[model samples]
Target: MIGEMKAQQEEIELLLSAFDRLVEIPDEERVVFRTLIERKTIPAQSHFVLIGEPTADIGFCLSGLFRLYYTTPDGIEYNKNFCGKNEFIAAYSSLLMKEPAYFSIQALMDSELLVVPFRNFETLFDRHACWEKLGRKIAEGMFISKERRERELLMLSAEERYRLFLGRYQHLENRIPQYQIAAYLGITPVALSRIRRRLT
Candidate 1:
């Protein structure tokens, strides 16, 4: 029982540290947020968010990896993004608009997440200036990440995209599958193998 409590405290502190990277949470607010948040365990290959499902909670990954992907009606899947430890993952559009999610969030491995219900979190934006500031900062961060990815995809060659992915997420090279990386780079697996051979 004591060990379980300690583990829970550690998870809370880990998530708090991640939030600190974006905004400083006062002790009182931290306590409140902790109360509002819950810990969830996702097994490998489990889908956190499914296409056409409403996103009710935003997750802060404490451990493991998650991939955001979309599948066409024809069953073609494309990996849009990957979120690893200490990062936030959500179907932002669906969360904000309370609509069906366009993409799915899937666990690449067994993962632990700190999750907060959007309704509870959004209410804090009106209740506290700091929360409002945090929300804006989060949105700005997301926008900047999206814009940078768009530019890279538009201007960079397939090989260049692969190189950029390596430079940015070298740690993930072994953790994620090559096919997913190829999909993210907008290239086929065979093409990715050729690029790797050329670089080597």
Candidate 2:
């Protein structure tokens, strides 16, 4: 009763905060956006997006962690990024182009997400100026993040990259498995162990 109401209130606040990261949502539009968004809980190891499948929804993480990864034909998996609480998660390339995703997104823990269907979300771009600005801001943020990651991958040493990873995602270090962290660092588990030993 009271506990459930408090939990719901907390989740609503989190959702609003995430939306505000893109643009300030007007009171009237906020109500409409909240009405359209849906809440989903994904169990550990389940996927939010799958390789070769169209991404129909974009989600904001309410709680828990997700890994965005790509698999080669040989079945080797490489983690591209992790999305944690309050961050947006989407196969954006696929979402924008209406094509199958090249990467997959999976929860590393039981996670709650606030999701909006891409079709419904896209309609807001044309319907409202605020949403249009929000869309552009999201795009610019993604591009900047991508470029920063690219530079780090190309120029940083393995140890340096590990340090950068720690700086960027230290909050996730204890929450997810070491092997996934190793994969994101493009290092073997044994190598990651050595790096950890050296850092400590």
Best lDDT among the predictions, by candidate number = 1
TM-score of each: 0.96, 0.92
How well is each residue in 32-98 modelled by candidate 1, as lDDT tens digits? 8878988899999998899998789989898899999989899878888899988988998888888
For residue 94, what is the lDDT in candidate 2?
A: 90
Worst 10 residues of 2 by lDDT: 4-13
Assess the local accuracy of residue 171 in candidate 1 as a C-alpha lDDT between 0 and 100.
95
Error of 1 at 117 (Å): 0.6
Best-fitting candidate, scored by TM-score: 1
Segments of candidate 1 deviating more than 4 angstroms: none
lDDT of 2 by residue, 89-194 (tens): 8999898999999999999999999888989988887767888898788778888888987898898888999999888898888888899998898889999999
